[model samples]
Target: MSELNVELSETERSFGLRQIPAGHARMLVIGRCLPQPIGEVWNALTDPARIGAYFAEPQGDFRRGGDYELPGFSRGTILRCDPPRLLTVSWMPAHGNGGELEIHLADENGATRVELLYASVRKRFAVMDPEVNEWAAGPGWEFFLDNLSAHLDGREVRPTDRDWQSMEGTDRELYEARNTEWVRVREEFEREHSPLPSPE
Candidate 1:
């Protein structure tokens, strides 16, 4: 129960539509700087043991073109792996639609700035609201990064579900505030960009 304080301002979020092989995909970009060296942050992200400690229990081959699964979460193939820098994968979640996930890491003044890009295609016949989608996905990534930050700071990390349930007091209040912030950001993004054309 390390203090669950997440600064929404620390994260840069954007929403747009991109063309993929399947069709038009809604792209969500979230970037935040972690106060740790680049190499240390990279290892925490790629190493199975380190990832399991902070994120989820990872299982499967972890090389380029290899398949991997984060039990009860998402499973997909490792599309590209460039150590200490970039890692791209085809992300197929246990629920909802699948997408492409890319992690970009860079050295920013001796600290690591990690950017996560997730793009999921709009279902052909299913109607979806881009604003709803952005807000829903944004907070989840923020939560994961919060855990990563705690882990980097040498704080105890807990399973996502249990950790979420255990949130109380200030932590719970901050979590709720984060969600509200996401809604505000999404609303602003929607006003700036026209909604995607309805699926045929």
Candidate 2:
């Protein structure tokens, strides 16, 4: 297995490291810590307006047992909610490839540790080549979580900003390097965990 050589930032937790076996599908968990209390962190997540500041602009009902439409993208159902602690939802994409999105909040010392789990993702690309799917989910979540950290640091939220494109040139360079490392790590992880050959 290849070793990762890049120095990752504190906020660079991406999807390449979190693939786990989940029955019929793979489960991906991504997490980051915001230097804020759990209550405030929870507010930012559950409050639709504040959520839009970092991630997608959530519209329509987004509460427990309500139907949620992710900004202008997918239609989902809010399966469960425990204020400031956990949330579970199902995302049904436009073309019908979707999965369960679960968010967990916990107190880490004083900061809020935010863990997001997306399970049973139905992406054909994952079957074709598992590591390839990281390209689709990793960087975007990294950007959004970084935005959350920025927001908690009292920086104004740039509601519609993207790293690879909208970020300043130097910033994108760093992100590109980080993304490259993520892909490499994922490839190695898959190789290291692949099933062994059966005896002849």
Q: Which candidate achieves the best TM-score against the true structure? A: 1
Candidate 1: give the clashing pairs: none
TM-score of 1: 0.81
Error of 1 at 34 (Å): 1.2
Candidate 2, residues 79-143, lDDT tens digits: the string is: 88998799888766555655667889999998888887665445332212333323244554555
- Against the true structure, candidate 1 has what lDDT? 0.73
RMSD of each: 4.7, 6.3
**TM-score versus the correct structure, for each prediction:** 0.81, 0.72
- Over 4 Å off, model 1: 1-6, 122-135, 162-167, 197-200
Lowest lDDT block of 10, candidate 1: 125-134
Per-candidate local distance difference test: 0.73, 0.61
Backbone clashes under 3 angstroms, per model: 0, 0
